[model samples]
Target chain A: MAVEIVMPKLGWTAEEATITEWTKKDGELVQRGEVYLLVEGDKSVNEIESFETAILRLLPDGPKVGETVKIGTLLGYFVQPGERAPFEAAQMMATQAQSAPSVTADAPSLSTVDPDPYAGRDKRGPKISPRALRVANELGVDWQKLTGSGTSGRIVEADVQAAAAAAVAAKVAVVQAPPAQPVAAQVIAPAPAPPIARATPAAGNATRKTIAQRMSQSAHTTAPVTLTTEVDASEVFKLREAIKGDAKRSGVSSVPSYNDIFAKLVALALQEHPALNASWTDEGVLQHAHTNIGMAVQTERGLLVPVLRNPAAKSLTVIATEAAQLVERARNGNISGDEMRSGTFTITNLGMYDVDGFTPIINLPECAILGLGRMVAKVVVIDEATEKTAIRKMMTLSLTFDHRVVDGAPAAQFLQRIKQFVEQPYLWLTR
Target chain B: MKELTYTVAAREALDEEMARDPRIFVMGEGIGKRGGNFNTTLGLYEKYGPTRLCDTPISERGFVGLAVGAAMSGSIPVIDFMMVDFILDAMGEIINQMAKMQYMSSGRLRMPMVLRGCIGIGGAAATHHSGSYYSIFSNIPGLRVIVPTTPADVKGMFRTALRGNDPVIMLEHKNLLSNKGPVPDGDYTTPFGQARIARAGKHVTAVGVALTVQKCLQAADQLAKQGIEVEVIDPRSTSPLDIATILQSVKKTGRLMIVDDAFEPCGFGAEVSAQVGTHGFDDLDAPIRRLSGAFAPTPYSPPLENEIVPSVERIAAALGELVKE
Candidate 1:
């Protein structure tokens, strides 16, 4: 018997997916667990593996590369060598006749005359109730290919409701994956001109679309307030230089970057002001128990934030090594969906681009985000009594918080603690 | 509030109405002096003399015809037929004269008569004694057919029946006569065309009448242990069937099952299933199912008789299957 292969449900909320590529050609003998195709759902590419060890028989009329299809749509069949696939002989006959072929030979037997007494009524198409059809239309579910669990194999309202719930779960999965773009690029990017009459905008890829949707959602849903503060980074920079010197002497390959040091310091500051590490919900504010900080990395595809779990509880060396790997995976498009979920706070640094004091959008659900500017040398007063000046390293920190979650004073106090940690590294690092 | 048996509660309603009205009287065999075969008129014979609690011979047809004439003459007659099966002899008087007197008289004369009977197949009551023919009376145009299950509903509905001018048929299930439930202390009347949600649930809606209502409640309890909640609805009256309440429950649960101890063909369940199918079609998540008594005569054997009607276990199992769909 030939085994039918269909588009699998990627996530609970994923109704359809676009086929990106097919690794296995027609008649290719593929083993179980071998990647045969790649499909994109909710801006993420997922590799689909063959479930049976059989010769692949790609259907001539099946969905092609770049074609989007609903979940459970039959793509092709896997048949044994020398075994005729389903619909093969019919297609050949239809081609010869150049007309619609009669279904006498392959038509399903009437349930009353069928030898299998326990089988349900063999209908030509899905048997759905009026209520189920209404609900399916309302939820935008393709119910034609679904098997009914109702009596006498009839689709009912409950089945449609379950499908709608699964689709919602898939949408939630996309929301929790990644968020936001590079601050410098966002500031410099020009708005597109209004289209002329009858002119259409160019359709972008799934990643770009997802980024646009999330960025717009964050902007519209949040009551944003950006607070910028100049931090004297002389001590924090010296602390990193000393660690780098020790690592070089000890032959340690991994050295903590400023972002990693800031991630640690921010986690400690968030611990003191726990409200900053919380999410706003209609029910109440959820104060996260662990400090999972998301580091925004700009990749070729789009912006991806890989969350580092409980950074406050980890050592600086571990955070540096893990952050390096996470950034590498995210840029290479190898980061799994799980790695980008459940972030309590986010940090997007534009220090490498020589940007200074740029506001960043808040990554929602999270209460606040920290944007770091480049550290540069500036003349500052060393002693107010003597009126003497000295060169010190200064970096601008922009904290964008959702005002609905925390007040201006509390958010400013949290930023003050972060500045205190940067000016005096011993305050938090010693603990 | 005070709790009373179904029989006692109904008797109290009749006794209270008889005391309030001098024109009201009861007629049945062995009821005047013997105080009714089911203790229906227990002490009413002494309070209201023999003229009021009048006894007649074993002639259902003769007295039923006389009650129709007496009702036309401004007297309210309460006829207590011991077994509902015996009323089959007086079907002509009930369906034609008693059900159409007020309508035929152009509202000039009133037919204020209450026909009470014991109906149900239990206690080994053979084919001759056991019968539930509420569906036949409900089909008549001018008759009000009430089949109350709980003691509270029986007492309350009985008051409404006596006060109304239309002829009413009150069929009390034999199995539910001794079942006890709380009744309101003072004078109260349960209006017709309203249903009671005996138990609230979300998974499946089970609409039952009379004995089936009690059985569905028991089945609901058993199904609750398995996390399968079943809502039970009792349409207290058969003629003025409260289909709105049943429809609302079906909308919430999305599934419906009608549990009836009467026969399946043209039975009360058939009526309810048709009404719900027409009015509440979109609310259904499954086929409207009817768990009714077998289409056979009442048997003499206890086990055979038990097999005809739906039991608690059968109702629970049917509800479990309906909920899965």
Candidate 2:
């Protein structure tokens, strides 16, 4: 028999839960009592365990990451040795709902998806039930011959039996070592004269699609301007060196990466310039107290900005250690979408890639974003009194602020404060 | 090149290999006169005569043991187990002796024997006869599992099997016996662990073996009309799977789905799915899908029997999901 893996009804008031990550993918065998998936409800992430040992079949178009699906939704199925999923019509509809852009369709962000038959999913891969497999094996059933009426065209046991009975009635294919496979081939290999096109870009995943919509919204709605400034990063570099040594002596286990500096110092600057740490909402400009700095990391999955909560309050080493773990989790695709949401501001560094300066769009709902460029040694005038020039470590900081909430002057003042903190790391401790 | 059925192509491979190697011999039930169960060895009996083509009693363990001993001695013996399902009759000899003897012998002895049979669910032959066990046989250490999808592929792979110096088990799909296609003339051998692209498309790479290959192609065709292109790959052999071919195809297509005529759990589809999931993950835009045989018994009733086999509609549906916007 098969077990129904439904969305858990966490609390009486909780209406839905979002599936964070499926620890075990579909078609993988899972043992009883083992956590096979993770779901988030009421801000708490829960590992969902399998009640029985079985082969898993996840609903293909089901709730993706960041999608908050209703409770009791058919998340997937777990079939023991040889059992078929017992999903009814309503549950089937819920599974097929993923066929529609489950993320963009309901988000109200993208109004109408381009109506190309090419836009949505088309019929190609078969979804055969366990009973269907054995029945096909028992009767030498050709899988391609039957169309499933099940959810997303899954081949139920009934469909297999109907296909076999229909074949027997057709007289073309019957019980035997398939008489003259030429006749059988007619049923199996339909006229595959040629293909339409061999190369089309696969549909973008849910996360990337969400990123696209949000970025588009941010670009379309916000009146943003970027202010660039070159600051002497010598003090920040020395600070990093001292911290690394202190971390080594204190057994801190984590010497913060250079990016962690932006998370730390930019967060401190936001605390002083509270106007910069605010969002331009429809109601009014909402200011925030906690300085949660989103740190963006690039991965093949996509660009993920995991929020480092209260970076200003936490020690540099603590922020660095947590940022490292969050980045790893984000890269490994296990970090929850919640970790990416609700940031007061964002700090992205392209210094490692040797990029000088590039304007960064504000992550939606956040008022400003700070982009850190590569720190390079350049000959510069240190003192005009003696006309002295020296080689100093310098980096370009590009801060894009929402003009709707803050004017150019305040934005520049915010940038200067960051520059001041960058030029002298000792000021933050003294303040 | 000559147009030939899967049966005749398999026979030609046997005939040509035996003519090339005088030490090769054939043994099975009704193979000498009645032309074996599926007619793959129809004419070899008359052409090679009794010594080279001998029909044995239905004692699977006895004849299989003899074939292994014969292989250990010198001659290359190609034995047939009427049905892969009936292989249970000689499980001890096949799983233990024939599969492990070479490893134990080290460099001293070799077992260049072949166990040929028809696999896959078909003919409403009930549970006992219609069985697809390629995934099970692939688990053994010393066996090279080769499953051919087309007449041309069967001709090429069977020759490759005949030439290899290991215990090669070649499975012929029951539904494809009469399927006809162009077979290349003269010395041709389809290399093992190399996948064949049955059909090419841009969207999804759907891999199938033997019977399912045809299903994938058919599904690909249906998807093409709908403007969703699906690339179909046939890893002609399973044990030494041509994962590179699959990976390259996936790298191009950005999505992968495997169709196995066997059961889903620990089936050919599951193993291949696991392999690509780990290695070709970054290249994929969608999660890997496996359209495997239902994990139920091969039932007696035709309707119930057909339920377990993955079909064209299912393949196209899986591709549809993979190609979804």
Candidate 3:
């Protein structure tokens, strides 16, 4: 029996993701829990792990960077000892959607709706979902008209719901409904009216059409959870400077970023907190055997997360070289589909854009995501007894996870492990 | 192996390559039985039949894309866009797709394609056709760019391009096609990444490519009569630019003047001048003089076009000025 690999749903609003790199070759026999590929989605790169033990048989074709592969297409095939093929709900949905005609051909066009749910989400900019934007767009409701009610005044579903209800009521009051003469009102409600185009320039720039579908699927099917914490990066800064002269002597250009150290720390932490590095299914929790870390790259086309496989196994120099090459390829538009389909966990750093902190969307089914913030220098009073003040680097770490599988204590402990690694990064070398 | 004219040399490259390799073919407007607008493919249609010597619609975008797709599929395609300015119409395929295809594919596929276009100003080609735009393609990566100043080079470079694995933009000077030289009477391939010293000198190193290389040679002859030893370097390939030869010449001369028919800003002259200033600045006795086309599009009037771009007189004056400095 051959199993077709479909595009994985990442969040409530993410419809599609860019393939970053393939960890396993097409002919390689993959164990159920082994890391398979990397995807750039939800503004971060994530490692997609194998769900079943099988051989990867095929790879899809598309542009390296900007081409958007529709969901449910065959990423590859898997042969097994089974008598029949397993049901791929995602692949079926994608095919049925492709073959069957759309509902709202004559209705208002949704062509202008931003395709990417994570569109307009700069590290320091507004965080809005593709769903909320779509609903707002469908009814010609202006996003600027509704005040945000979520964290940091981000417009959530409720805001869209409120706007939709208000529009519905206004329509009911002004326009009279005609006497019923049709067989049914459901079909007449308007085949999914082509999404409406929002007038905002920011919305136009970041819309990913595939992002909308995956996000809708994730929200409808998966349970989401989030966790948050504060991590001090004072020591990370010190260690980076300490290695600068050494890097120069070795002919390397610059020191690895704090995010580089944090990526390694997160990988180490996931090993100890295996629960956080897994997928929750009806059968059981799938714990990944190898850690493939995905780094989020914000490109001109959209957000693509390319993964760095077994980052923990490689030295910092190798990690730096791989990371730089992956980022460049993603920008140059050369990543493959197998690379974007499978990922275990994700990390998104907004420090380069000077943002303080943010709630990153969970790349779905996967347990958690790490959100990094700008590292700011602050004065700290080390001891009240001595009355001595010390300057240190401080930053916020936000972890959004599915609480159904992981408890708060375990999540905190995992974060603490990450903090320890960040503080004493040289310990990674010893390991 | 026959006596091929500069134009015929190009036609033979298409004819011989198409005859030798089934994968090789020619596609361009008016390049079929009608020959080429410039007679570069004068007799290819009857020889190879229409399928191999295909005539394309006057759509630069469509033909460039077709050529790109053919190259990706392992076919050797010789695409003639008629004029270099026509390349601007298909810039998306040329720069975005063709230039980055190899690197983007992680070295998976090689684009074995050749883009032939006529450049330089003459015959009242107007604003659209009269352009010396070699710098535009040279500055970009993944494209092996070359400028052939003589009849022999046009044949040799085209032969090389037909055989090499990389995509090549063969910049043919409109003014130099008829100016014949003692070309080899047999199959020949001029290796890319090599610079030719047209004239040997010691006072200053003067460099140019394409029609401007000829201008520099003429300028060198005029200056030589006045006891000025001027070295003229023609870097046939611009992208795999023979910077070593250019720098070596500059290092010996202690002064330099780059004469080119292209504009000064972001032009090849500016690049050469900067390279000399940064790489061999210590060896300089005077500031580098860059005599280039005026910062304007090539005009329609022959006199105006001639005035805007570098001429033999302007190049000689620039060389004289460098010596005086």
Minimal lDDT window, size 10, model 3 chain A? A175-184
Q: Write the per-residue lDDT of candidate 2 for residues A1-431, one digit (tens) a residue.
A: 56778899888898999988887766666777978888999999999888777878777766776788999998878875334355533554555566764565446653333234442234334666544555664565766567766544656556767887776444311211112334334434557668777866544465675566567667767898999999999988888889888878988788888788778888888888999988765446766646888988887678888999988878877887899899999988899977876678888888899998889998867889999999999999989999999999999999998999899998999999989988988878565
For model 1, which pairs clash?
A12-A166, A13-A167, A13-A170
Compose the digit string of candidate 1's lDDT tens values, residues A1-431. 79998988999999999988887777666778988889999999999898778878888888989999999999988987566567775764456446534436655634223334322245336888767876775565767767788766888887888887776565544545444356324643558757558645443356676676667767877889999999999999999999999999999989999989988999999999999998876545666667889998899878888998888888999999999999999988889988888888999999999998988998887889999999999999989999999999999999999998999999999999999999999998788
Candidate 3, TM-score vs. the true structure? Answer: 0.43
Q: Which residue runs of candidate 2 sit more than 4 Å off their true CA positions?
A: A1-431
What's the distance in Å from true for residue A106, model 3?
90
Residues B199-298, candidate 2: write the lDDT tens digits. Answer: 8888778888888888888888888899988888888899898888988997777667888888888788888888887887656555678888777778
lDDT of 1 by residue, B54-157 (tens): 99999999999999999999999999998888899999999889988788889999999999999988999889888898888888899999999988999999
Worst 10 residues of 2 chain A by lDDT: A171-180
Q: Per-prediction DockQ, in order?
A: 0.30, 0.01, 0.01
Candidate 1 yields a Cα-based lDDT of 0.87
The CAPRI-style docking tier of model 2 reads incorrect
Lowest lDDT 10-residue stretch of candidate 3 chain B: B1-10
TM-score of chain A of each: 0.55, 0.53, 0.52
Fnat for candidate 1 (0 to 1): 0.50
* Best DockQ among the predictions, by candidate number: 1
Report how large a share of the reference interface contacts model 3 reproduces: 0.00
Per-residue lDDT of model 3, residues B93-192, tens digit only? 9999998999999889889999998998777888888887778888898899999877777788999999988999998888888876667777778999
Supply candidate 1's per-residue lDDT for A309: 88
